[model samples]
Target: MNIDDILAAAESEAPDTRTVKVCVNPAVARKRAALLEALKQAKELDAKASTTEERLGAAPAPTTEHADRAQAELEAFDDEVLKSLITLKFTRLDGERWSNLTAANPMRVDVALDRNYGYNFDAVSKTAAMLTGVRLSDDGEELLTPEQWDRLFKRLSGHDFRLIIDAVWTLNEYAPSQHIEALVKGFGAA
Candidate 1:
C-alpha cells in the first residue's frame, strides 16, 4: 500500500452532528410545534396559579366592630336557647293527647339521617313504619296534629343545641372548678 493509503487508514472518522433525518410531513411538523407551544403555555399557567394560591392563603385581620357584633349575637342566641331548654316539656303519657298530637295531621318523614352516623332512610323505614308516616289509631282521639309535632320536635332540637352551647359556655365563662364539681356530682364522672 502507498504511504497516503496507510495515513488514511489510521485517521479517526468524524462524528455525525446532524439533527434532521428524513424530512417529516409538513402537517406533522406543524402539529408537533403546536403541541410544544401548548405545553409551554400550560407550564406558565401552572406557575401563575401557584403564585395566586400563595397570595390568597393569607387572610386580612377582621374589624373589631364586626367581630364584636358577631360575638354579641351568638351570646344572645345562646342565652335564649338556654331559656328554651329550661322550659320545654314533653308529655307523652295521656293516651288521648298522644293520639291527638300524633294522629291528627299525618306526617311522613321523607329525609332521613345520612350514612355517616345513622342508617339511611331505606334501612330505618323498614324497622319502624311510623318513622316514615304519622297515622291515627283505630280509635280517633288525638293530642297534637302532625304539624304540632313537627313544631314541638323542632323546638326540642333547638333546646338540645342551646343546652349544649350553654354547658360549654358555663364551663369556659364561669368558674371552672365549680362547673367541674357540678358535673362530677351530677354526671358521676370518674
Candidate 2:
C-alpha cells in the first residue's frame, strides 16, 4: 500500500526468488537502447536479404558480403583478444572423476551454476548433479533419451569431452561471462 509495505514485501521474498532490476545511468541507458534498436534494424535487414536471396535464388552482393566477412573477422579478433583461455590440468584421479561425471550427466547444470556465479560460492559442485538432465532435440520439441545422450557422448573424443568437463567446472568458480558460457555450449549451436 505504501513505501514501507513495498519494501517489506521485497524483503520477505527468498533471496533467490527476488527479481533483480539493474538501473544503468540515464546516459548509458539511452546508449544501450539506441544500440538495441540498431541491432534490431540490422537483424531485420539481414532477414530480408536472406529471404530475397532464397526466393530469387540469387547470391548476395559481393561488396556487401565482403564487408560482412571483414567485419566478422574483426569481431572474431576482438573476441580472441578480450578472452583469456584457462586450462585446468588435472591428475589421473581428478580426470577420472570429471569423466565419470560427464558420462552420467548432460550440461543441464549451466543455468543453475550460472545463478551461483556472482553470489553463492558454496553450493556449486552440489548443484553440478543437476547436469544429469535432458536437452531439446533439433526440432526443440522433445527431450533426448539417456540412450541418445550416451550415443552422442560416445561420439566425442577424450579431448572433446574434457573440454566440456573443464567448461562445466569453470562455470562453478567464475563470475558469469559470454566467453565462459561459450566454452560450455560452443560458438552458436550444434
Candidate 3:
C-alpha cells in the first residue's frame, strides 16, 4: 500500500473504540516493511553521496610531518643541483677558470630548505655552497664576489661529500666567493 493509504489506515485505527486488540492487516505490514526498506536505501545513498562529495572536495592540507618529510627528501635529492653542476663548464669570469664555478639555481634548493627547516641564512648559504659549488649572489644575480666563490672552492674543495651537499651547491651557484671569504675571514671578523 502507498504511504497515503497506510496513513489513512493508521488514522482510522486511531479512532477505533472497540480495541481489545486490533488485528493488523498483513498487507499493511508488508507495505510498512517496504517503506522502511526504501527509507533505509535512501539513507544509504545519501551517506554514499556525502562521502563522495567529501572525497571530491579540496583535501585538507598535509600535516606538518608530511610536509617536513617531503622537504627533507627534496633537499636530499642530488638531481636538482647535480645535473646542472655536470653541464656547467668554467667560464673566465674575472679571468678565473675555476671548474667549481657555476651559476646558482635557487628555486628547488630554497623551496626544499624553506619547507623543511626554518630559514637560517648562514646554514642555507653554507649548504648551497657545498652542494652546487656556486650560489645565487646577494643581489639575486650571478655569482661574482670572491668571498662566496672562494668558500665553495676552498672548504668544499677536495671534499665532494657532505650532508648538506644540495645547500652547498645552491650557495656555489649564488655567491661562491663570499661564502669562501666568510669561512676564511671568520664569521663577523670579515
Candidate 4:
C-alpha cells in the first residue's frame, strides 16, 4: 500500500479512532498490486528466497540480462528525443537581433550551437574570434589571423558584423556549400 493508505489504516485501527471495516482506497490497491508484482519478481530472481542478500547474490538469468539491455536502450532513446527537442536548428538567423550573442553571451551561443553539432568553441577562442576577423581552417583544425586580431575585435565590438560572421561560420559547419551560398544571398536581401 502507498503511504497515505497505510497511514489511514493505522489511524483507523488506533484506540483513539472509532471505525468499522477500513477499506483500501482503489488507487492504493492498484499501486499495491504493482508493488506486489515487483516483489514477487524479486523473490523469484533470488531462488525464491525471502531476503535481500540472497537476491543480490543470485546470478542474473538471460531474461534479466535482456531486460537490462532493453532498459538501457530505452533510456538512450528517451535521451535522444529530449536532445532533439532542446537543440532544434534554425535555418535563418537575424544578425541584428542576435548581435548581443557575439559579445558577452558568446559562450552561451557556442554552447547552444554545440547541442546541435556535438561540439563547441571555448569562451576564450570564441571571444578572440569575435574580436579578430579570424577564419577557422577548412578542416576545422586551425585558426588563421591575417589581420590584426585586436583591431578587428575592436571594430566588431563597435558594430554588429560578427553576428553575420558567426551565423556564416555556424552554417558552414552544418550545411553544404550551396546551402551556405543560399543563406548569404537570403541575408543580403534583408
Candidate 5:
C-alpha cells in the first residue's frame, strides 16, 4: 500500500450523519401519537372487514364506514403534524476537532480540600458547543447558533430536546459495524 494513497483515502472520508424529526409542541405530539394508534386500529378493522366480505360475499357496512372515517381523520391530522415538524440533520466532526471541542468543555467535579463534593456535566453548554457546526438543515445549511440552541432547549419539552440530542450524539459516536450493516442491507446482502 502506498503512503500517499492511504493519506488520500483518509482525507476523502465523509462524516457520518443522522436526521431527526421533532415536534416541539407537547399537545401536538400527544395528539399525533393518539392518531397513529387510531390509524393502526383502523387498519386492523379494515383487514377484518375485507376478510369478512371475502368469506360471506357481503361487505360489512358499519365496519367499513368506521374504518374509512378513522383513516380520513388520520390523514388530516398527519398533514397538520407534517407542517409543524422541524427536521434537523447532524453530521459528525472529525476526530481531532471532536477531541478538542470535548476537551474545552470538560465536565467539572466540585471537590473540597478533604474530599470530593460533587460533579457537574454542564450538559447544556457542552451539548450546545458539540452541536454548533454539526447541526444543519436537510439542505445542508447551518441551523442554529449556540444562543438559539439554548433558547430552543429551554422552549422544547424534555422528550423533544432529547430527540435532537440523541441524533447528534449518535452520528458522532456510531460504530463502524453499524455502518457496515446498513451498507449490507442497502445492497440486499445476507
Candidate 6:
C-alpha cells in the first residue's frame, strides 16, 4: 500500500470506548442485593426439592411457590434498578498521552525478576485520567467535567466505583488479542 493509504487508515481508526452502569441510590442497591440473594436461595431450595422428589416421588408444593415468588420479585426489581443506573462512557486516550500518563503515575510492586522490584499502576491518578470529562451521552453532546466526575466517583459505592475504573482501564490498556479471546470465550468456542 502507498504511504497515503497507510496514513489514511491510521487517521481513520476510531478510539476505543466502554460504558459502565453504576447504581447511585443506596436504597435501590440494597434492595437489588436482597432480591438477588433471595433468588439464589430459592433456586437452591428448588434444586433440593427436585432431588428429594426423585428419591421420595413427592415434592412439597410450598417449595415451588417460594421459588416462584422470589423469582418474580427479582425480575420486577431488575427493571427498576435498570432505570436508576447512571451510565458513564469512557474513551481511550491516544498512545503517546497514555504512555505519558502511566509514566507520571507509577506504583511499586513485587516482581518475579531480580530484587523483587516491580513497578505497577497508580490506581488514583490513572482512574482520574481515564474517567475525567467522560461523555454522558451517545452523541457526545453531554459530558461530566473533572470536578463533576470526582463528585460522582465519591458518591458511588466501593464496588460500583471499582467497576467504573476497571472498565476504563480495560478499554485503554487491554490488548486486541485479549478482546478476541474474550469474544471467543463468550461465544463458547474451543
Candidate 2 wrong stretches, greater than 4 Å: 1-138, 176-190
> Roughly what TM-score does model 5 have, to 2 decimal places?
0.62
How would you encode candidate 1's per-residue C-alpha lDDT over 51-163 as one tens digit per residue? 66667884443224433444454555454343332221121122243334334433444543333313232222211221222323335433455565455434444334334
Model 5 segments beyond 4 Å from truth?
A: 37-62, 108-142, 174-190
What TM-score fits each model? 0.23, 0.24, 0.20, 0.21, 0.62, 0.61
* Best-matching candidate per lDDT: 6
Model 5, 25-105: lDDT tens digits are 667778878987887888788788778877897754445665678778877887777666766666676666555555665
In terms of TM-score, which candidate is stronger, 2 or 5?
Answer: 5
Off by over 4 Å in 3: 1-21, 58-190
- For model 5, name the residue pairs that clash: none
Estimate, for each residue in 72-187, the C-alpha lDDT of model 6 and write its tens digit: 99888887887668777677776676666666655454534212312244353345444543645547636676677667767788888777767766765665548778999999
Instruction: Tell how far residue 76 is off in model 6, in angstroms.
Output: 3.6
Number of the predicted model whose TM-score against the real structure is largest: 5
What local lDDT score does residue 51 receive in model 3, on the 0 to 100 scale? 65
Question: lDDT, candidate 3, residue 73?
Answer: 49
Q: For model 2, how does the per-residue alpha-carbon lDDT over 1-190 read when each residue is reduced to its tens digit?
A: 9999998996786421111122213344444455556555665676677778767978754224434544454555443332322122221123355345444544444466535343232232322312322332335433445575455455545554444444445543333345467776875653
- lDDT of each candidate versus the true structure: 0.38, 0.43, 0.40, 0.40, 0.63, 0.68
Residue-by-residue lDDT tens digits, candidate 4, 67-143: 44444545545543433221111232234422444344434433675454443433432443333322333354233
Instruction: Give candidate 6 misplaced runs (Cα > 4 Å).
Output: 40-63, 106-120, 123-141, 176-190
Could you tell me how far off, in angstroms, the CA of residue 107 lies in candidate 2 after the best superposition?
21
Q: Which ranking of candidates, highest lDDT first?
A: 6, 5, 2, 4, 3, 1
Worst 10 residues of 6 by lDDT: 111-120
RMSD of 1: 38.8
Q: Can you rank all candidates by TM-score, best first?
A: 5, 6, 2, 1, 4, 3
Question: At residue 179, what lDDT does model 4 achieve?
Answer: 63
The C-alpha stretches of model 4 lying farther than 4 A from their native spots are 1-110, 121-147, 158-161, 177-190
